[model samples]
Target: MPEMLMEVEEEDDVVPNGRVLITGATGLLGRAVYKEFKDNNWHVLGTSYSRLRPRLEILNLLDSSAVNGLVQDFKPHVIVHCAAERRPDIVENQPDSAAMLNVGASENLAKVAAAVGAFLIYISSDYVFDGTNPPYKTDSVPNPLNLYGKTKLEGERVVLQNNDGAAVLRVPVLYGDVEKIEESAVTIMFDKVQHSNKSANMDHWQQRFPTYVKDVASVCLQMAEKKLQDPSLKGIFHWSGNEQMTKYEIACAMADAFNLPCSHLRPITDEPVGATPRPWNPQLDCSRLEALGIGQRTPFRAGIRESLWPFLVEKKWQQTIFH
Candidate 1:
């Protein structure tokens, strides 16, 4: 587990370059964001409801009082809000919980962060846009197709409206350094493909840009640094990987990475039936961040390979009958 610094000692005289408070610090993207700020010599504190540890502070963003108390005590210069219900399918089934986390908690956090004069960065998703468009920009209109996207879009609005200095960063599908394969939509493909004896149907229709979590974390750090230097950095931004791939393509890549046979994997050429309604090819136009030199796109092949290699070794699935 990566080290997430706890509350600073009251007597510590040395002032750090900046202080950052990261919500959902135990999650995939949150973990990366926490590490990025800490590595750059910032006084960083992370919060999580579950996955609690010795150094992390237990925070439930939904509780207005708890949220307010923590932000006031930490007095961070920036608040990176990464906690939310990101799974679309899960959101569809659990609308109430999704709204509470994605909407209510975000709104509360925005209000609290504003009271402390902290710069807020709310992590959003590309699902805000409908699938009919390609290469969506920051100004693109949002028409979320499912409950998850809808709630996230609502979260963006509340955060920006509540906090004048809030910035909404919309990213595409993400995968990196997960504690479990099922933790990420991208990494889970390996699990599906490993069942080589059974036939698996993978979606090859809706195009997706599988962004890396580490890269997103780097961008968050850069944005926070720049925002401190220039307060005008608040607004909407887009950061995504350039490589375009479908689920079938991603599964095939994972199989190739581990030299596993994927003959039983079949590609579904049409929209996935009866599942969550996801946008097709809602590719984000990342020129805004690129122009400012504020992003990075790791090649899909290399990135996914690195992410899944450890799991392969751990599971002892590296050896095959033929090899």
Candidate 2:
């Protein structure tokens, strides 16, 4: 816990904004956003589904009264909507939960945020598009392929309709700052490659463009900052890492980064079998984000090097001490 707290807090930081309300406060990106807002001295209130810690206050987003009352009392200037049933498999199995949490809760938040005259920012996904296209723009029509994507798209619509100043940020698969490497799929591939003795069959069919959590959080904050002046900076915007690689290629890159043996990693050129459909080419064009001068610039290799740091060092230390 001390280490987790320490992982945050860079020497340089931004000045505080007004109050902020963040849902899914304990999630991967949620936690990062919370820490970022707090570090910058913003009055930050975060909500979680489960009782996680002192910082995260558990609240049932389905309970419209609870959500409305929370916003009314907190009176946040900005609301970062991060809570949702994001996993495709979980959403597929529990469609009810997905609809309630993703779509319904989003509508509730947007209504409250609008009533309170607060700027809303909804975190959306790349899966909103079917894999038939190579790159999607902000104005691209969403043709969701799974229940999760459907709910997110619906959530986006409700949010934008409710609050004209609300921003919908569509991001690709995000990875970074994990307690365990397996917490992120990208890092999980790296972990598997590092620990496993035998070669692995790496998927090479679908194209993936993974963004770092910090980058996404940064963009969210920048948009929020812009809202302070230009309240009209609202609409669908996309942010992604500049890198485009297949899973196999990413695994190979990870192998090279960690000095692991790549001979064991065999490229399997086939689509992955799953209960949910995956977008083959989820390459999003960030021209909109770039036009606004808020584009993400973290190169994939540099981002990985930053992410792998203390964790990799700590792992090697544990290995030495235990062995």
User: How do the residues 40-121 of candidate 2 rate in per-residue lDDT, one tens digit apiece?
Assistant: 7888999998647786777899999988888899999999988888888889999997899999999989999999999999
lDDT of all predictions, in order shown?
0.89, 0.84
Give me the displacement of residue 170 in model 1, in angstroms.
Answer: 0.5
C-alpha lDDT of candidate 1 relative to the true structure: 0.89
lDDT of 1 at 171: 92
Backbone Cα, N, C clashes tallied per candidate: 0, 1
Determine the backbone clash count of candidate 2.
Answer: 1
lDDT of 2: 0.84
What is the TM-score of each predicted model, taking all chains together? 0.92, 0.89
Over the stretch 31-108, how does candidate 1's per-residue lDDT look in tens digits? 999999888889999999978976899988888999999999999999999999999988999999999999999999
